[model samples]
Each structure stands twice: as structure tokens, then as C-alpha cells.
Target: MITDRLSLGLQLLRIIVAFMVGGYAINECTQGFSSEKWPTVKGKVTSSTIKEVFTRSGTSHHEADIHYQYVVDGKTFKADRIIFGGANFRSPKELIEKFKADKPVEVHYKPGEPSVACLETGVNFTVLIPLVAFGGILAFMAFADMSKSMQPNSSIGPRPASNSSGLAQPKMQQVKGIILFTGLVAAIFGFKYGINAIHFGAIPGNAIAIVVLVGGGFLFVTFISLLPAAAGMLARARRFDLAEKVAKLNTKIASTMSAHSYETAVAYGLQAEIAQEQMKYPQALELSKKALNVLACRPKVDLAVNKFDDSTNRMIKESTIRYEKHYNDTESLCNESYGSILFDMGMYGDALTHAEKAKRLAQDNLRNAAAPDQAGTKRALAGALALRGKIELAIGSPENAKSDLQESIRLRKEIPHQFEEYLAASMADLASAYCVQSEFRMAERTIEEGLKIVEGSNKPSHRLAKAKLRAQLADVKMGMGQLSNAESLLMESLDVREELLPAGHPEIAKTYLSMAKLRDLQGKQRDAIGYRRSAGEMLTNCFGPQYQAV
Candidate 1:
């Protein structure tokens, strides 16, 4: 079956090459006619000489190298074009014979552009033929490659292909050819118009239009090429595991240029998060490092915002602000990912450092982001605070943990977000912190509120979070010496966990451990021992014989 990754790569590449090179050639050829309306001036040939030009085949030929000077509005200018591009590659002996030093000529120069002058004004077929021929061949090759990648390898459903972002790959491939064909006319004519704005004068190639178009073209080609490359890397590593695929993707993306750094950082941050979810702390940390490194390569948000006060380009300034916010959001996610990973690894101090970084970045993002991004930005800040609070709780700083988690909960309540389950999780954390302080009533109250949030959501993850909250509530009851109530809560939590989690999940084993403890307190020794054995077996099955539920 044809993989979507290969198809996507070819698709993006075809669009870029078809648009840029084909457009460049078509535009360069067509724009020579614009010089016909240029005003004429009395000019003199300043220099005319023959230069020996060597070919790759070890042969030699001679061509005319000519220059002329003219005056426009009392300013003297020099030029070399006989036509717009001056592509008559005939004998230099003939050109020298026709025009010599101090020879009089009529120079056609653009009215506003004194330097853009030509002795002759008309289309140059010598330049047009080769460009059209070469461009056509490349465009044909691009389409052919696209066609090849879209073919099916099997008669079954579309081949399973997905990117790290989980976009609809097969569907995109089905219509990518149509997209390219429809875009061809627009890209060609737009390139023709955009490129023709370049007026080469005595200075040669000094035009903002040239810089913008060339830079845009280069980015469209090289930077977008990385997407298909990424798809290929992910597809090749499918057999190995997500970690391998993520590693390969990140290694390539991390080496990209500054213009791509924000995207690279965002990709790495997501990879780090996935690694953490898989319980791969070392891989998570490595991916987090890559995210941070790329983020460091991006433009500094503070400096760009500081320049806003003095800038006249309101559109540019707005775009710059948006760019700054994107970086801020990406960097915040990177730091938050690292903080979560380090916290899971029990490196509380190190986790706190990254949590702080994330909090600050999210705060900055909140201040400058566009209206649509406000709620999402607040969620990021809440996430950072929640992570830092968890780390604080782990390190015996209950007061700090309580404060951070409360503010995090407050932020979550302040905005209606899609991550309402996360708000529940933060509440559970706050309850745990309260439990750590021996405030049993406060802990019970917090856990109950968290339960309400989780109970409203039917998502599997939310259900698992509810089970955890249930377990926490049981602990508060056990501390209060409500033995019957505590036992009832444990049994209920175990039911939910068994129904929701896989048999080998660590959470299941931990729930079994709680059941064993509750049984022991109820004076059922044999039942308690059986629960312990079940917990041990679950842990052993998941993480080998040496591992325990704790």
C-alpha cells in the first residue's frame, strides 16, 4: 500500500517546485515587454569589450561585455542591459564593431528608475526558450512523483499512515493533485507580477521585492520539505515504537533554521509529553531538552515587544506580536513538559525550575495573545502552576503546594476550557496537599468538589481520574477512623479502576494494595494476603518480578 508519508512529501515538494521555479521562469520571460514604455535618453557607450567564455566541455567562445552611461534628471547612471536581461549571446566582435567607446546611442530607461536603462527594448527569446523548457521539465517530474506516491499498494482500505499531529493523511493524498493543478495558474502569474517588481539599476539587484520573494521561495521549498521527511521518518519507525519514531523526527527537526524553530519546539514539546505519558522519563527529558534548545533559537519575545513602541508599521507590529505570542506558548509547553517529566522522575528541585520557567512564559503569553487564544493561554498557566504545585508537595512544601494549586484551580474556574478534567485533577492534588497538612475535613471537601467535575465527564481518562479521587477520599476517611466508610470507598474505587484500567496498569496494582490494607484493618487476614498476592502478580506482569506496587 502507498504510505501517506511518501505521498505528503511528494505533494508538498511538487507544489513548491511547480510554483516557485515554474513561476520564476515564466515571469522572467514575460516581464521584458514592460520596458517598451520606458522614456528614451541620449546616451554614450562608456565601454565595450570582448571576453573569452569557457564551456564545461573544455571549449571556448567570445561574447560582448558592454556598459553605457546616461543622465536622468541631472543624475548620471550606468547600465549594461541591451534588453531587460540582455541575452543576445552572439559574437562580441560584432557588438564591438557596432558600438565602441564614445559612440552615441538612444538609451531607454524607466521613468522613475534612471539606472534601469537598455539600448534595445523588447522580449528576448534567447532567455525565454531555455527557462520555459527547463521549468516545464521540472514541473512534469514533480507531477509524476506525486502520481507515483498516490498509487495504492493493496486493494484494501487506505494504508495506515499518520503524522505525530494525527492529521488525516490518506484523505489529503486523495485530493493533493487537484490542489496543485488549481494552484498552478495563480502561483505562476503571481510570481510573474511579484518578481517583475525587481528593478535592476546601476547598483544591480537592490530591491525589497527581490529579497522578499527569494526568501519566501526558499522557505517554501526547503522548510516545507521537512514535513514529508518527518512523515517518512515516523512511518519507517512504526514497527519499533512511538519512542523510536519521536526520536528520529526530533533529531532532524532540531537542526532546522531559526525561522522554523518555533514549529520545531512545538513538535518536540508534544513528543516530550507523549514520552512522559508512556512513562519513559529519560526519553522525555531528552525530548524536552531538544524542545528547549530549539525554543532558545527562536526570536526573543521581550525584545520584539519592546520594539513595538517605536515602530510605524502597524501591520508588521501586530504580526510581530502574534509571532512573539506563538513563541511564548511553545516555550511554555516545552518547559511544562520538562517539569512534568522531572517530577515523575522524583527530581523535585529540578522540576520546580522548569515549572517556574513555564509559569513565566505562560504569563507572558496571556498578556499578549490575541482574543481567541486567551482561554488556552490561561490553561497553560494553570498547567504550569499545577505541575509546580505537585513538585512542591513532593518535597514537603505543603504551604507552597496549596497556594499554587488553589490559584491553578482559580484560573481553571475563571475560564471555560475543554480541559475541565484537568481542573478536577488539580483539585485532587490540592486535596492531597491538604491531607498532608492533617486537615482531614478540608481534604474531604476538596476531594468531593473534584469528584463532581470528573463525574460529569464520560471520557475514559476522566473516569480514571474519578477513581483516583475516590481513592483519595478513602484515605481521608481512614485517617478520620471511619473504618466502615473507608472500606466502602476503597471497594468502590477498586470497582471503577478494574472496569476502566487495563489489568497490567500500575494504578490497578496500587488499588489492589489499598484493598489489601483495608482488608487487614477489617481483620480479614486471609483476604488481605490474597489481595497482596494479586497486587504483586499485577506489578510483576507489567514491570518484571523485581517491581512492586509502591
Candidate 2:
């Protein structure tokens, strides 16, 4: 009998709290809308004071206590309420200053009841706290009841069926619904409170608002992070589709080529050259072969067989030479494209061989021509130089890498329309080369120039490059014995790298290693060890234990 009574009492309390919360919410909502249409009157603040109240735990909080008189319908009324549903504020200085004695302010009052007056119309802590608590309690109770019903042999009859994953599908749906609903409620209140805090210009209120906004933002990011990785897969699929399209076009153009149209062949050859420049080697190779086939199919008009003059023979020979040069240029670019792709794939030896071959072919072409293809020759030379520099650096040949990188930089500058991103990247690599040679000041200056070029760009590649340059700068600073500046730059680099790269990326591991070095320089032995351990673990996870040597 006592157990039954206790259960009954608990149920009664839950129902009462639920009703009270519902009624409070409804009243506040009605008053909020009603206030918009409420008549305004000039009111004088008769009295205003700061009141301090202590909680049961003896923590004191302050509130502004203001009494004002407003005349409505030719009769004066006194009211203490500042805003509908608002409780005592944590810091009431702003409110107190606003409601000084004899200060005239606008008062909003109900049409029939002049006693119902408010300075503002909004739901506040007075309503929000109870509403949230009671709502949460009700939801918990419902969830508990549902769980009890779902158990085996419960009086509530058969439970819902579960899916193949052994989880009740209905329950999963309910959980998702609850989470989404709670998030929506939090977002709405967070935004409303943030705007209100800003509107009132309350310092403490603004702090609370910031916390709410940040929490809401984190929740939003977490929600988005749960989405499927469809976008990345779709992008990869699209690139493959484009590559296939290029292959098909090349085949079609190859089969339809005629003997009389060398111009058409040259156009396709240029297209192939462009594809090679973009590092699409498979497409470039296919197009280059097709262009070569078209050139081979051109009519062989020999002057000896046709009994033509020496001038005509010379003209024919000149045209053939031009065609052969174009074909050789396309071939060289295709080799360079292969080299670039190999470089990106970390096949250093293969990349170096192809890069050298492309460089030699471009040089030979430039030497033989009366008027060289200046742009093509420069592009091929610069690309080969950059690739060779990177390969040398990877193989620990700092002097060779520095020489090639410097030459590449000079060549890139000589080009009329310079590729800024590539130039900045080469500068960053050159800075790293300088760092490898312990040329701290030169490394710092080189990276600083690169940063100036890329710092303002929002592209991910630019940002990633900038992060890498910052890490190199940090290393240079460390070499210079500027521990404090090195630490700061490393931290900034880590932030950008973490934002740009995926977790456990090699770049992130390198940044951690730099941070460890900085900590060691600063005499933080414990922190240095910890950072080094983190770097080792990240590198091991990303590239196996052998790569953790750094």
C-alpha cells in the first residue's frame, strides 16, 4: 500500500509540473504577441535600486528593482515588471542605469488592463528554465516507460520488431527524432538570447550569448559531420568520366583525320600539349598518338616525283620540318606530364628520368629552331627544373635541389603570365632547401615572400601551401635560436594544417615534429617528449613505423 501511494504521488507531481510548464509557456507566448499591439505611453521611473539575493548555497546575485508609473486611459498605474517572463538578471547594472529615478521611458500596457505593463516582451530565464527542466523530465519518463514496455514478458504486449542490426528500428527513429527536436529547440533559444544580449548591450549577457552560440555552432558541425561521404566519391567519379570523354574524343578525331588538313592535326596536337601541361598523362599520350597518326597520313608530295622546282621542294621541306617539330614538342610534353604524375605519386627515380629527358628534348628544340616556341620551351624547362629540385631534395641533396629550384624560380619569372601558385610553391620548396643547408635568414626571407603571394587566397591548395611555408619558417626560426617566435609560428601552422588536412595526414605529423623541436628548444623536456611521441604515433599510423624516425 505504501509503494502504491508513493508511485501515485510521483505521478501526480509529474502531471502538475507538466501542466504548470505548459500554462506558463502558453501565457508567455500570448503576451509576447499581444505586446506588439499594446499601446505605448510615456512613463517616469519613480524608483530604481539594485537588489541582491542569495541562493540557498549563499551565492549572491543582483537584479535591478525598478518601480515606474505610467498613465493609461487617463489613469495612472504603478508596475514593477520590466519585461514579461523575465527573472532577475545576473548583472543588473545596465538595467539599473536605464531605469533611473524620473527618467522617462516607453511603457507597453495591455488595452483593458493598465496594470499589465512591461518594458519589453520576451521569454527569459523565468520561463525558459522551468520549461526546459519539465520538458526534459517528461521526455525521460516517456522514454523509460517505452523501454520498460519493450522488455521481454512485459504486460504491454509484444514489443516492436528489430532490424538485422539487432537494434529496434522504431527506437532508433525515436532517438533521432528526440535529438533533432532538442537541437532545434537549443538553436532557437541560442539565437534569440544572443540577439537579445546584443540588443541590451549587457556584458555578462554577451558572454553567455557567446557560449550559447559556440555550443550551437558545434552541434551544427557535429550534425553535418554525420552525413555520408558522397561528395568525395562523386567528385572522383566525375574526374574519371572526364578522362574517358577525352579518350573517346581522341579516338574519334584520329580515325577521321584526312591528308589535306594539317591544321586540324596541329589543333589536336595543341590540345594534347595542353592536356600534358595539366598533368593528365594518359589523355596526353592518347592525343599525342592520334596527332602523330594524322601527321603521318598527310599527302607525301615529293618534288622529285612531280618534277617540281627547287623553291617548291624547299617550301615542302620547311613545312615538313615544322610538322616534325610540333610532333617532337608534343612528345616532350607527354614525357614531362608522366614525370609530374610520377613525382606526385612519389616515384622519385622514374620522375627524375622523365624530367631529364623532357628537359633535354626542350633544349634541343630550342637550339635547332630559328624562332623557338618561347612559351612551350619555358614551361617545359621550368616544370622539369621544379620536378628535379623536388626529387633531389627528397634524396637529401640540398645543394643540387637549391640550384635547380633557383633556376626554376628564375625561369618562372621570365614567363610573361606567371603561374603564381606554382611560383609560390617553388619558393616554399626553395626555402625548405635553404633550411636543409642551415641558411636560416635566406630560408626565412624566401618563405616570407611566398606567404605574401598566397596568404590572401582562400583556395584550399593555397592555404595548404601557406601552412607548409609557415612550418618551414618555424624551422628556420628554430635554427636561428628564436625559440619563442618558432613556437608561435609552429602553433599557427598546426592550426591551419589541421583545418586543411585530414587527421593523421603526413603534413600534420611534420607539424607535430616541428612543435616538438620548438618545445625542446624552450627547455620544456616533458612537453617535448609528449609532442615527439604524438608525432611518432601519427607518422606510424599514416606511413608505418619506419617513417617515425623524425
TM-score of each: 0.50, 0.43
lDDT string for model 1 (1-550, tens) is 0012234445555556545555545544444655666688899999999888897779998778888998888999997777644455556788787879889999988767677677877656576555454444445546655664444422122334343221243346536645655565565456445645565333355553674477466655544454534443443333225544644555465455443476566566656655555555577789789878887876654433445445645656667677776677667767887888776555678889999999998897777635336766777788899999998887889999999999998887776323445777888889889988899999999887777665444555667678788887887887788889988888887887777554555677777887787788789989999988987887676555644422
lDDT score, candidate 1: 0.67
* Per-residue lDDT of model 2, residues 1-550, tens digit only: 0011122223334444444454445445456546656789999999989887897778987778889999977799988777755655435788878788899989998766667778876556565666656545554544443443334421112333433222354466467547744763574455443432222111233554574466445433322221111222222223334534443444344345544354344435445544543345466556655555655565554435236677787776676656555555554554665565555435678778877876787677767755345655666677778878888998899899999999988877666443356677888889989998899889989887777665445555566777778888888888888888888888888997787555665677778878877888888889989988887787576445654332
lDDT of 1 at 7: 43
User: Which RMSD values do the candidates have, in order?
Assistant: 13.6, 28.9
CA lDDT, every model vs. true structure? 0.67, 0.62
Candidate 1 residue 205 C-alpha distance from true site, Å: 32
lDDT (Cα, 0-100) at 59 in candidate 2: 98
By TM-score, how accurate is candidate 1? 0.50
